[model samples]
Each structure stands twice: as structure tokens, then as C-alpha cells.
Target: MEEKFLKVTQEGHFFDKHKSVLIAVSGGKDSMNLLHLLYKYQDILDIRIGVAHVNHQQRRESAEEEVYIKEWSERRSIPFHVSYFEGTFSEEAARTMRYDFFAEVMKQHDYTALVTAHHADDQAETIFMRLIRGSRLAHLSGMRVVQPFASGELIRPLLPFPKSELMNVPHFEDESNYSSLYFRNRIRNDYLPLLVNENPQFTSALLHVGKESELLHQALRDLICHIDVTNLQDFQAQTVAVRYFLLQHYLEEFPELQLTRDQFDQVLNILEKRANYQHHLKGDYYLIKDYQRFAITKIQPKTDRQEEEYVIESEGVFQHGSFIFSLNEPLEQPDQIIYLQVHQPILLRGRKAGDRILLHSIHKKIRRYFIDQKIPQKLRDTAIVIEQEGKIYGIANMVASDLSKSAKNDIIKATLYIKMKE
Candidate 1:
């Protein structure tokens, strides 16, 4: 059994051979078997092993499962961490809390990577789920062996092994897994059997397809990275062209991956308009256009913000009003006279009723001059104004001046970045 598991790990390139691994254990058959296999090969593989369990508090027996795992780890002298989440245990909520706890544990222990017991059957079920939900090529690619998690990496070592093999291993079954109401169990029991009856090699074929799709997906990602347009002016326009070119290229090579005529046109329109657009493709893949770039994100139901932001100092990268202010050195240019200086106690506040700037070039009141320039009245209050010593020196999104004539050659520079509010 150990030799067979070792072969499976080799096939999947599970742990990079020598990295420390944390296995998410639920005292379920798959997780228990995974822990056993890892422990069996720990010395040979030069791997440090740890177990993490999340007591979701969903089922009454969940507490028993946690106790079993805790005792099991203690008897074996393996490090173990457990987290309990109270209240609701919706699948999404449970997953989110579980990963959050796992990440914290991983960070505390400085673990290099996390291993999961997601096997070939899991991959097949994922693919089917995405396909039924209208996923794209990227979505159909299924679970990746190595993927980025919070602070570390998630490695699926058992992907190349079948669930049949996992069942054959000495393990305990979770009664919860028998419910067909859960999408995954439904696919496993009802759908997978039909596919297997039709073609005994269906699971293997899906796994093979998943591997190939993963390679293709990686190549596409590499191409996008290689064509980095970070500094290109009108980057959004360029991104639109890049996306269109990619779609065309894929269509010519693999027509099966092509979006429908209307869908393709919609993508083109989204690129051309440079707007946020969500495209539901044939498979469970979604093309999301956010500002300048396009991404193929998974099609999960909309989730609330999982991360929260706290108030920060006004000097550094801080969120103010509805904008992210990243204070940096102002661009020095001979023609541009509106730049703030360092150590200058400039107040960042909203507009005042009697705000006025000395237009050095014109020698006139800035308010009157702006009125003459036909500046809109609606923008008066919301505009940011920088004031010092009860006088407006810099108008937000407008202009600034050198207060002291003696400091003409001082070359003081400060920048204000106004971000759009969502």
C-alpha cells in the first residue's frame, strides 16, 4: 500500500520530494488514508508532516471526529492543529473558514506547502460540475496540482490516484458523504456510475483531459505574462486587442473552445468599450473584464468580501474617502509648477466655500479664473484642496504654486493620486 501511494505521489509530483507538508484532516476515509501514506513515506521522502482539522460543528458526530483526529495525532506524536467554527456551516462558509484557519496555522509553523486528498475522482466531479454550469476551457481544466493559497501553496498529491484505490485503503467513511443533495456526492454516486457503465475508462479519460488542459492553460498564462503591457499607454485598448487576438488564435486551432457568434462579439464589444463585463461561456468558465485586463475566473456564486481593510496612516498607501492614496515623489518637469514638497504639512480636506488660489501665471483668484474657464459647479465641493496657513496653495485635480519666490530653485516635489470611487 505504501509503495502504491509512493508511485501515485511520484506521478503527481506531490510535494517536490522534500518540502514540509500540512495535510487537512477531517478523520474521513480519504484524509485518514492520506495522512497514513504521508507518515509512511515521511523518512524516505525527507518530509515534515502535520495535520490540520476544522470542526465545522455541522453534524453532531463532527466533535467525535475531531477527538479521534486529536488522539490519533497525539498517539503518533505528530503535530496537530484544530479550529472550531460555530453557527452556520454552509459549504461555502465552511470552506472559507477552514482555509483561513489552515493558512494561519501554516504561517505560524512556517510550512512550505499544504497537501490535500483530492483524487482523480474529485477532479472528474469538478470538471462535470463546471461543464454543467457552462464553464470555459479554463474552468474545465479542473483542479490544479499546485495552486496559490493565502500565504503558501496547495498541493494535491492524490489527484493521479482513483477514489477506488482510496476506498480500498484502511479508512473510515463519513455518513455525511452519502447525501445526494450535495452536488459533489450527487455527481459521485448518480452521474459517475452512469459514465462508468458506458465507458469503464471514463474517469481516466477525464483525468487525461484535465492534465492536457492544465498544460494549455499554463501556456496561455505564460503568453499573457510575456506580453506584459504594464507601462504601455492606452493599456486598456492594447489589452482588448490582445484578448481578441487570443480568442481568434484559440478559435482557429480549437473550434470547440470558441465562444458563440454573439458571445464572441460581446467579448469584442467589452474589449472595445474598456468596461467591466462578465461573460458566461459554454462551460463553467467566466471571462471577466476588469478595467484594463481580462481574466478567466471560476464561476462560483457571488461571494461577499472575504477580506476587510482597516484605516491606515494618511502618508503611506491609505484608503481615504473612496480612493487609495499612494503618496510618492511628484514628477519634476520644467513646465509643471504644481507640485507639493516633502515635510510640508499639507492638509487633505474637502473643498471650502471661500477657497481661492493665487494663479501665479495669471495673477488672478483661482475661483474666478476657474469660473472664467467654465469649470463646472458640481465639481466644486468634491474636489480635493491642499491648504496651508489659511491659503489655498494647491487645488485637488487642478493646480499648485510656489509660495516663496526665494525657493524657485528648491525643486520640492509631492504627488497626489486621486482614485475613482466604486
Candidate 2:
């Protein structure tokens, strides 16, 4: 299936030598075959390969499975990392821990990409799962071959491969998959077989549907990503359909905000009416309309106690009430973070008058900057601003000064997050 693997890689833009990949292995047939194939072609593909395995320790054989994968990695001289969970795990908990481990492995090992062995059957199962959940096509299309990740791009090179193709590989069997105890297991083992028996090509049919879903996503992405935002007046005057796609594209870059259906429609309404409105979405998000523009911001709750500013003297994360001021992860994108050369006493305080930034070679007053960014007027006065020696280093979502623009290698960065009141 080397040709099949090549077809998927070329089709998905999955791998490259510049970015190292951390393959998630479970010693199961699918992941085993994936690791084997990647290892076989590592030199030819000009990519470095490593392994990340998580032992949730939920089962009796979990440790044995970890040892098996560890020995497999060592025998091939491949880099490997394993994380053992310490707490009880629900299915979602296990999944969360697994991805969390994947991210940590990537960061600690300097690997820039994550590879998962979710094959065609898994894709079909996901589609079936989402269909029953009454999911929208955006959520129901199952998994994409490529997705932007904080660590790097997550790629599924086996989206086109089937379990039957990988079964020949030597692997461990976790019989939990066949057990009807889990909901997915019931779908896979009980319901799907009935459909597959009726139509042998059912999985292939679902694969085609997934491919089309991706095409639609790509088309919308192309239309939205390069949209003429420079002509603000003309752009803002566009139809609601245009603004919907704009928000879709915006959400891809900022994953923290979970925009719900009501919130999204409200966003479009705000764009159409050009008025003041505030609607709370999940994740502490308040979709606010600022005249002609729309913004997603967080509200600091009011209590009998007064809000206090924080003195951040070192590279660390600290929280004061609903506000969290964190020394952010190392600079990822240039525009995403600010740099500091020294560890000075930085005060995390509310926005102040005359607080201006020289952003992108233009001097903008903080009030004007907030207006330009469409920050809600209420949030503008109380927005978090990081300052040192009377120089505004960073605002909530901006690297304020041109001088403080972080270089690619800069590690000192900071961010502010406001937790929504319960």
C-alpha cells in the first residue's frame, strides 16, 4: 500500500522534512501499520519520525501495551515519548489526555507536526456518529486530513486507508473496541455491519461524502481568507453570507472562542443593523457589535470587591479573580506575540488614557486602537494592558509597539484571558 500512502500524502499535503512529525502509536493494527509505513519511507520522504504513545492505564494490559510500543520504537532507533495518566478516565477524558500528551510530546521534543492513524472506517464511524447527533456539515464531515494545531498542523495520512489493508501488519489487539459497552463500539460492531452487509462499499461511499465536504470547506476558505479587508467600508457593507464565511475563516485562527449558532446569527444581525448588542456564547465569549464592526470579547464580572491590578515580575502565569495574565508560550506567529529583552516589573492593569501603541509603523492611540479593533467600548476601558517603565508592551490581542514586535526565536511572551462569570 506504499502507492496508496503516497496518494494520500500528496492529496493531503501531509508531510515534509522541515517539520518533524510525532506519530501517535497505540500498538493497534492501524497505528502499527502507519508507524511502519512512515518509518519505511522516512528517508525517501525526507521527514523525521518520532512516536508518542499514551497509556491511560484504564485497562489491565495498558502497561504491557506501552512496553511493546517502547520496545518497537527502540528497535528502530526512533524517538519516543510516553505519558501515563494518573486518574480515572471516561472515554472523553482518555481522548483529552491522549491529545494533551501528543501536544506536550511535540513541544518537549521539538517536533512540529502530529500524525494520527484514523483510517477510513474511523472516518465512516465519525460521520455516522455525527449524523445521529444532528451535527451540521461543518461538524459532521468527520475529520479533515489537515487541521491547524497549536503545536503545528495535525495530519491524517491514512484517511483513505482501510482497516483491512492494515490488518496484515503484526499488532496488538485491544478487544475493548469490539465490546458493545461503549457507544462507538456499538455503532461500529453492531449497527455498521448491518449497513456494510447490505452494501459492501458503504465506507467508500462515506469517504466520497467526506471528500466533498472538504472541497466545500476549501472553496469557502479560499473566498474568505484573501477577502479584501483593506477596503473596510466596502467589505463591511457586504451581504450576511459574506460575513458568515469571514467569521468561519476567523474562527480557524482563534480556536478559543466556541461560536454557537445563536451567537453566529447574532453576529450577522449585528453586521446588518450596525447597532449595539451583546450576546453571551460559551467559553466566556460576548459577541459585541461596535457600530459597523463586530468583536468577540470577555466581560469582567462585578462583585462587592474591587478589581486589583497584578504585578508580574517574572515569566509566569498568574490569575486575579476572573482575569488571567499568563506569560504566553514562545512566540509562534510574529503578529501574535510581543517580546521583552529584560525581566522587568510588568503591571497588568486596565486600559489608561494616552495609552497608545506604534502598531505596524503607525502611531495609534489606545482608544483609537480599540475602536479600530472593534473592541466594545466597555471592554476598552477595562481591557488588560501589559506595561513596563511606562511603555505599553502588549494589549489584549496586540503587540502594541513596533519596537516590541517579537522575533521568530523570541521566547518571552505574554497573554491576558478573562474567564466568563458562571
Candidate 3:
């Protein structure tokens, strides 16, 4: 395996030895093997390797994993990039965050490629799962050895071996992997076991299918690589594999967005003939087909505030990505409440360019307001703002410009209420 690794590493011809790499570690034996192997052959490979970890914070031991990985990197004098995410999220969401962090780290730190620990067993399981799900042959080819991701190459060199052969490196197992909640879990626990019981070489057989499918898939990619725009009328006449490959390439740009086999078929069918077709995708995006061409597009994010002095659209509850906003009359009990007056109309949304507000009759810029409040930059990008007329009613609980009390005669105070949904 080591010789094979070295042979491929040289034949691939990517290393000047000066170029650096980023390894995605999950505190598992497979990832640990990747780290250890890279270190073992670092001198010969002539490349630098850095480590990165995404703490999904899904399990009780997730923090421990982060610490373990971080300390291991530090001990080896390797650069480390780490991030934390809150709440239990879907595997798709977790994968998105992981890649997002990896990309950010690569761009910020100048890494050449991101390496992962996907191996032959993983590919086999993935192929079988896709098979049971009725996936097309091309789609069942399993993970690629190398692909462009986040402006850098995402390479997996361990696909030649399974976890049993990766190493005996010390690592922790994620208990959730043993759970029955996930389909992949069932595949691993039930399907793979049953197949292997019938024939111990079942995984090897699956891998063989993957290799053949991948060869055919690559051929389609090479053939279609020259075709710029797929004509709607002729798309259906093409081989099913060709159409599937086109959609697969289209989806590569957005790894977070995924389509099942049925969904993939539906997209192709809709694009081939259906006019005025639109499919809403996850994460505020959608696929729209115009005439002969189809493209993935983002939904224009809705905001309550359209322009200066926009009146409140309604006095009812308004929900944005993660925050909830509402308007109410001054209540008897108030906590974390900002006072506002019944001005023109009110609107709530994130801050925009050139957004200025008046607080205690003092003019303040929204950008400066977020900085002064010590709100993190990412959160500030989506900070909820309450605005009326040209003045800011509230800057996300920081400043609530009093607009209701125009004169001393007015006693009742209107209120703007905001809370982040958990």
C-alpha cells in the first residue's frame, strides 16, 4: 500500500514538495492513518501538510475530538485550522459546513489541496446505497480520487484500501455511526454484513462495479466536456448516461445541494421538454429552465424593508433565515425589548450599504453600530435591523430609535420585539 501510494503520488505529478496540503481529520482511525502516513513519508514526498477539523458539536465527545486533533497537530508542529458548529444538524448540513471551513482555511492559509480519508470500503458502501436507492450507473460510481473543490483540489488517496488496512492508529469512534437512524448506517450494519456473509468478497465486487462505472463516467465527461450548452430538444435523444453526467456536472458547483436518483431523472425530464419549469432547491436556491437551457439560481432574499421609510408590511410575525421579528403595543412587562414609536411604517431585515440610524437623536452608521456592539462579522452580515422612514428604529437590540413619542402628549409607546430562533 505504501509503495502504491508513493507510485501514484509521483505519477500524479502535483508535488513540487514546496506546495502545502490541508488534511481533513475527524479523529477517526481512517483519518488518523492519513495523518500518520503523510507524516511517515513527508520527507520523501517533499510537501508540507497542515491539519483542519470541523467540530460539529453534535456528540458529547465532539469537543474532545477537536482537542485531540488540535493537540496532535500542535505536537507535530503542523498548522491547524479548526471551527465549531452548534446544534445537531443533518449529515448534509455538517458536510457543507466542513467543506466551507476547509475552503476558507485553504484560501486564508494558502493550502494547495484538501485531503480526505475516503477509502475503498466507503466507495463500496456508497455504491451499494445508491444501487438500493435506484441510482443510475454513472451516479453509482462512488467518490472520485481527486476533484476540484473550493478553488482547490480535493484529493482522496486512500481509496485503494479499507479501514481495516489503513492503520491501527488510536482514534475514537462516533457512536452515532452505529445508530439505526441513518440509511447509511443500515447499509453498513445490515446490507454490507448480509452481502459479505454470502460472499466475503462482496465489498471487492462492489468496488469492481465502481471502477467500471467510473471508467464509463469519465468517458462521458471527456465527450461532453466540449459541449457548452445542452440543447433541450436533443438532450433526450442522447444516452441516459450522458444526460445524467451533464446534471452531475451542473451539481458539482454546489456540493451542498444534492438530488436523489428520482430527482435527477425529474430534472432531466423537466428540462428536456417541460417549458416554464422551476424546482425549488434547498438553501434558498432553485433550478429554472428557460427554453433549451437550465441553470441553478438563487432566490432573491425577501426583506421587509425595501427602500427608505418603508412602512411596516404587517403588524404580525415576520421570520427571516434564523431570526424572528414582531411588532407589538407597549406591554406591561418588557425584557430585552426595544422601544419604538408608531411612525410611518416599519420594516425588519439585515443592514444594507449606506444604512444610517438615529439613536437618542444622534446619527450613527449601521456598520459602526455592529462594530461597537462587538457583533461578529458573519452575524453582522445578517443582523436584523428595524427601520422606519429614513431612521433606524432598532439595530438588533443595540439601538431603538424612539419614533413613537413625536410630542410629549403621546404616552403610549410601541415596541419592536426580536428573538433568534433556536
Q: Give the best candidate by TM-score.
A: 2
Which lDDT tens digits does candidate 3 get at residues 1-422?
66777777677764543378999999988898888888878788888899999888878999899999899899989998889876668877888788989999999998878999888888999999989988767667899887777767888888877877766888989999999888889999988999899999999999999899889877877887655433454565567766767778757666667777677677777777757677876667687665544566664554543323224555666555555566673323433465555544666656654355655655455666777878886667556676564455666545555443342235765665666665
Error of 2 at 249 (Å): 3.9
> Highest lDDT: which candidate?
3
Comparing 1 and 3 on TM-score, the stronger one:
3
The candidate 3 region of ten consecutive residues with least summed lDDT is 302-311
- In model 1, residue pairs whose N, Cα or C atoms come closer than 3 Å (at least 3 residues apart or on different chains), thus clashing, are 134-283, 134-284, 135-283, 135-284, 135-285, 136-285
Model 2 RMSD to the real structure? 12.5
In model 1, which runs have C-alpha deviations exceeding 4 angstroms?
8-13, 17-19, 167-170, 222-225, 229-267, 273-422
Decreasing lDDT order of the candidates:
3, 2, 1
Stretches of model 3 off by over 4 angstroms after superposition: 14-18, 224-422
In candidate 1, position 152 carries an lDDT of: 77
Q: What are the per-residue Cα lDDT tens digits for candidate 2 across 64-91?
A: 8999889989998898898887777678
Go through the candidates in order and give each one's C-alpha lDDT: 0.66, 0.71, 0.73
Q: Residue 374 in model 3: shift from native, Å? A: 35
Question: In model 2, which regions exceed 4 Å deviation?
Answer: 6-13, 17-19, 225-236, 239-246, 299-422
Task: For residue 236, give model 1's deviation from the true position in Å.
Answer: 10
